[model samples]
Target: MNERELQQLTEHISQQFFGKAFRHQAVFNDRLKTTGGRYLLGTHNIELNRRYLEEHGREELIGIIKHELCHYHLHLEGKGYQHRDRDFKSLLKQVGAPRFCTPLKTVQNKRRAEKRHEYICTGCGRSFIRKRRFDTSRYVCGVCKGKLKWLRTTDSL
Candidate 1:
């Protein structure tokens, strides 16, 4: 949704669930990574990750709004507003709001680059670590003209 729609949705959620009005602004933050939404402690404004809405749809967006509203309402009232706080937990349970935003599955499963591999000489029993894989058939041990056996892959030094 657009910024205007986001603002309206935030306000609507705040009023519907918290029984209070959201006086501060609500806007889509493109730079937000990992988190679905965040409440600015200093400004009392809420910034939502637009990717969350686009990927997860309206229901997930509403949950994030409610979760953020929990923080917003509790912090504004001088109650425990942080995730670990008793008041926050109780309010979340009462409102049936999610305790934490569901993380994007794609983000969680990102593959890291392979960094190292271990190779051993079949004849000499000597081991070698290389950053890149070498053809086992052509490459032979310097110490002995023995076949190279692939062992295991490692991340880094």
Candidate 2:
């Protein structure tokens, strides 16, 4: 759906679920990487991750909207709106919103499958793992001062 549909849906959900009208904009944000949605405190607008709707479907999108609405409504009402607040927790439970968004599998897999450069000491057979590739010729083993060689990298952490 477009931004217009999202705005209408947000207003509908706010009235249907909370018995309140949403007075601000609700739009799909392409820049949101990890979160399903976020409530902008300054503008009182709600930004939703379009990836969420594409990956998890309409139910999840609604849940995310509900979650952000919890933040939006509570913040506007001058109640405790933070995740740690009792009011936020109660409202989430009352409205059946998820406390946390599910991690995107593609993102999680990319993190888990990071390429780690491994090195082994010839003398001690000790292994060292690093995030970046390093020249073994310039660096010696710390324990035995032995020559180091590049080893095979693992697929997962």
Candidate 3:
């Protein structure tokens, strides 16, 4: 959804769940990498990752909104608003909000199974992992200065 829709949704969620009006702005932030949404402590504004909506749909988006709203409402009321705070936990349970922001599944999988190229030293028999392919003829082992040979490929999950 667009920024205007996001603003309206945040406001609606705040009122419906927290019984509090959301006075600050809510917008989509494309730069948000892993987090579903974030609550700005200084401005009391909410920034949501647009990818979350596109990937997970409206239900996940609503859950993220509720989670951020918990932080927004608790912080504004001078209550414990941090993730570890008792008041934050209580508010989250009351609203049925998630304790932690849900990360994008693709990102989580990518992080868990980062692709790596395995190479072995011909002279020393030592192994090395590189993210990018290198010219075996040009590059040598750092430890033994021996020729590197491609061994196998593995996912570093």
- Per-model TM values vs. the true structure: 0.72, 0.82, 0.72
Q: lDDT of all predictions, in order shown?
A: 0.90, 0.92, 0.89
Query: Could you say which candidate leads in TM-score?
Result: 2
Cα lDDT tens digits for candidate 3, 4-117: 888898889999998889999999989988888899987888888999898989989999999999999889889999999999999899999988766688887667666899
Rank ordering of all candidates by lDDT, starting from the highest? 2, 1, 3
Q: Rank order by TM-score, top first?
A: 2, 1, 3
Question: In model 1, where is the ten-residue run with the lowest total lDDT?
Answer: 105-114
**What is the TM-score (0 to 1) of candidate 1?**
0.72
User: Which residue runs does candidate 1 get wrong by more than 4 Å?
Assistant: 109-111, 114-153
Model 2, range 1-157, lDDT digits (tens) per residue?
9999999999999999999999999999898888899999999999999988899888899999999999999999999999999999999999999999887766676665678888999999999998888888899999999999998877656
lDDT tens per residue, model 1, 53-102: 88888999899889999999999899999999999999999888899888
- In angstroms, give how far residue 74 of model 2 lies from its true place: 1.4
Selected candidate, larger TM-score, 2 vs 3: 2
Give every collision pair in model 1.
none
Model 2: which residue pairs collide? Answer: none
